[model samples]
Target: MLDHDTAPTGDKTIETAEDLSSIAFGFMASKALFAGLHVDLFSALADGPKTAEDLAKAIGVPLNRIVMLTTALASVGLLTIGDDKKIENSPAAQNFLSKQSKYDFGDYLRYQIDQQMYPFLLQLNAVMKDDLSEDAIASYKHWMTDEEQASVYSESQHAGSLGPGRTLARKVDLAKATSLLDVGGGTGAMTISLCKEYPELHATIIDFPNVAEIGWRFISEAGLVDRVRYIPGNAVEVQWPGNQDAILMSYLMSGVPGDDVEGLLRKAYEALAPGGRLMVHDFMVEEDRRGPALAALWQLQHMAFTPEARSLSVGWLTEAGRKIGFAIDDVDALIPAMTKLVVFSKPA
Candidate 1:
């Protein structure tokens, strides 16, 4: 009943009901954030504070929506409102969302927006109902052939591996390695990163032909053609080329179901020569597999090949490797939660 001008400044009417309603529409906030990132609003703010009018000119967001959008971001703490009403990046935003910072996480936002993740957001029920009937996988084939789609997914993984991968790669002596085969090696991030670090390393990227073409292009861009080769084919049906020292599977397992995974792992065991290694870098959940919520959630999303509903665990790999005649070694937890690097080796 109170008029805005006459009312006291406060969250006077907000209640749990209102909060619940907000939660329902929380997706609006996500879309707005995505749009802002797409327009480079955060990167723009990275330079310094800017008034609404100034932001409009710099980032090209609709002039009218600027204040509303900026205010929303500020309310969420991604930005700060200065004394003069100029807005700037919040500390969190600067460290993670700003493009200029190497620790920047702006790409995190972009990947969701640019990828088919948005439609899925609107159609999650359909997605949950075994409903890729409407061409759902067109944009989100967990094993996508499109270079850009795969790159988006892989870069998201890179961001996650950021703190951990760097430290581990530096600490681990992959220099003794001779060869590696990266299954479904989209754009070759793991292989490329490893090879770039170890001069003695050579790798073969195995994936669908269309996907391999993209990985090849990316490898050429990195100028590592001499060190890595792309072998395009399906991992399930094809016999993985053998006589390799190591095989790297990064974030590829969870996408596949258990029976399929067992088949692939069996193939991997056969593919390795005596004393060779199989590197399974993925979400290494706890033994009971109750915690690590994301990994648990991912198991549902990755309904491929009808994998056992039980999450993939370190214990699972260690035991499974022994069964396949490969001794598990170097199975350490990598920095990013839900990702572990387990080395399975054939007996000499």
Candidate 2:
């Protein structure tokens, strides 16, 4: 009897099947990570390995649930179960996931990815069926309008942006820049990073009122309060401080309507002094909008929420800047294949 369900592939069958399964059940992996982060499991294991029973008691979860979660976490290689039946964080997990680690991004994973993005992704099918143009779930405007939501959004984004901000600080030379205008700089992650790197540089971060309030706290925490200032208002409508040595617009364009991006670029052009630099950092896709899989997936995720959101291509941005009296200086990947930094300068 021939089995209709199983298709015969020669040597590649196992690999192909595994790949397909990984894609199909990918949410399970994401959820597992989210769960582990939510419970601060890595932090609990930071001191040493612990038996599942010990972890359950420490975290106040049932032993059975902890056992199941540890199994899942081990499967994902975040932690490992040793011969002594104790689970310990993988080196990567200890370094990046533990709350005690300076590089911890667990909050980012929890708030941004798990809380904010995951719910909207659940409605991908409904969004497709309705041909939704605006956010079918939680709109960006609605989120920014609420005080609590805005704070949560800004803080989460700040946590996620810190790594890229550090990378940008290292890669981009801001030694010559004295003043910088950070447009829609939620929570001032980039500003804090750049200001910390350049003693002479001072930054003005413009964002909505609520988000700006949070940015103030972060700036104060970074001890860059003397160097960084907040300008609270709608970025598009506000009068941007002019004659700036540098302007940074990171992760802003893709959230707004496509038509507004060119206008914003024009604004950035006018705000810069002669020879002043402008940097646009965001998730950019290729002109064909094919896979660089992360950018493609991120674009779809944006579509699931923001109606005006679409992935901007580097080609489009370069042309747009040229038209606005700016010259392309450099294009570098801030996070390889995921986000990019496209730099332009006003002719001196």
Please name the candidate that would achieve the greatest lDDT relative to the true structure: 2
**Candidate 1 lDDT tens digits, 127-198:** 556554544452223446566666666556445445554555574566767888888676676777788788
Which residue runs of candidate 2 sit more than 4 Å off their true CA positions? 1-17, 129-139
C-alpha-based local distance difference test score of model 1: 0.69
lDDT scores in order: 0.69, 0.85
TM-score computed on alpha carbons, candidate 1: 0.80
Error of 1 at 150 (Å): 5.7
Clashing pairs in 2: none
Error of 2 at 14 (Å): 12
Error of 1 at 120 (Å): 3.4
Weakest 10 consecutive residues of candidate 1 by summed lDDT: 1-10
